[model samples]
Target: MSDDTDDAQPPRRLNSLEDRNAVVESALDRAIKRGDFDDLPGRGKPLTGLHGSSDPDWWIKQKLDSEGINGVAPAAFQLRKENAVLEDTVDAFTEESDVRDYLAGFNARVREAVMDLREGPPVFTPPRDVEKEVAAWRRRRNAMKNDSVTEAEPGDPEAEPGYQPVDPESVGSPRRWWHRFRR
Candidate 1:
């Protein structure tokens, strides 16, 4: 009975590797003829976000940028970026106390990153010296004040034409809240 059943069953034909390749090739050829891949965006242009570096995590960075996500970078990268702009940032503050506080907070974050055990890139950003930065900010502020004073000095030949020096007392006093309705 087993022999009769085997004889009755037809042999199943297994596809060879070449047969599979040929099927895929023919499908691709048909797709090409139909212009399925025509006019794709960035088809001929060199890829962006390479930035000439072979960083291993390039794909992840590309994904984040494509999604318009920000502030998700590793601590090391954020610290380095902040370090680069630290001087300009410190110079913007009007008060010495604010500058000191900003520097303290920045340094604290840097220190935290440096000591962090769970890692991505190593933190290479050095903490700013609060006193040194404050001194620099003070110098910048004084220099700006001197320049303004020199430029707006009354009766000075170097002063700009049609320039008027404002009366300090008049502008320095703030109008009360009711002053606006008085007008």
Candidate 2:
């Protein structure tokens, strides 16, 4: 046991930048040999966000976008963002119960954010009126249903102009040059 302990090499000291670089290079080389990075996503694609543009916070923005991170902003900003898309989000839900629940949660968050005393932007996002929103959602849903039902199928007599169905029986017959103008 004493001989085995003595034979084991001590950890290498990385005192200089060059020494650190060499250590990292050797570890990366070993990883390459082990194929640790062989199946990474976007391995062959060109790197994005490298073009010239004047954006001071580009790096953080890129990181946030790449990581699919959301709801990490200040409460005021988050509530505002949610408010902007509230209508569309409400429309996406098929159930009235779900819409009510979503609206309740959103309203609670807005109220809480308004009450928060920590120094930040003011929360101007008002709590959504659940009943009104639900009513609007119902109206939109009904309108969409009506529109779909009203749409005429292709080859329908009620279909819009410029839509003519071709005759299968005449498809195999060769017509004269004047046939094209006869229509």
lDDT tens per residue, model 1, 1-183? 567887685743537988778778988999999999899998999976757898898888889889998877799999999999888888888888899999999999999999996977999889998888888888889998988776546677557677577787888668899998995
Model 1 TM-score on a 0 to 1 scale? 0.46
How many collisions between residues are there in candidate 2? 0
TM-score of 2: 0.53
Candidates' TM-scores?
0.46, 0.53
Clashes of each: 0, 0
Model 2 ranges off by over 4 Å = 1-59, 65-67, 152-183
Candidate 1 ranges with C-alpha deviation above 4 Å: 1-69, 152-183
Model 1 C-alpha RMSD to native: 18.3
Residue pairs whose backbone atoms clash in candidate 2: none
In the range 67-177, model 2's lDDT, one tens digit per residue, is 999778799998898999998999999999999999999999998999996947999999988999999999999998997788787778757667688888888869889
What is residue 18's positional error in candidate 1, in angstroms?
41
- Compute the lDDT of residue 161 as modeled in candidate 2: 66
The CA lDDT at 179 in model 2 is 88
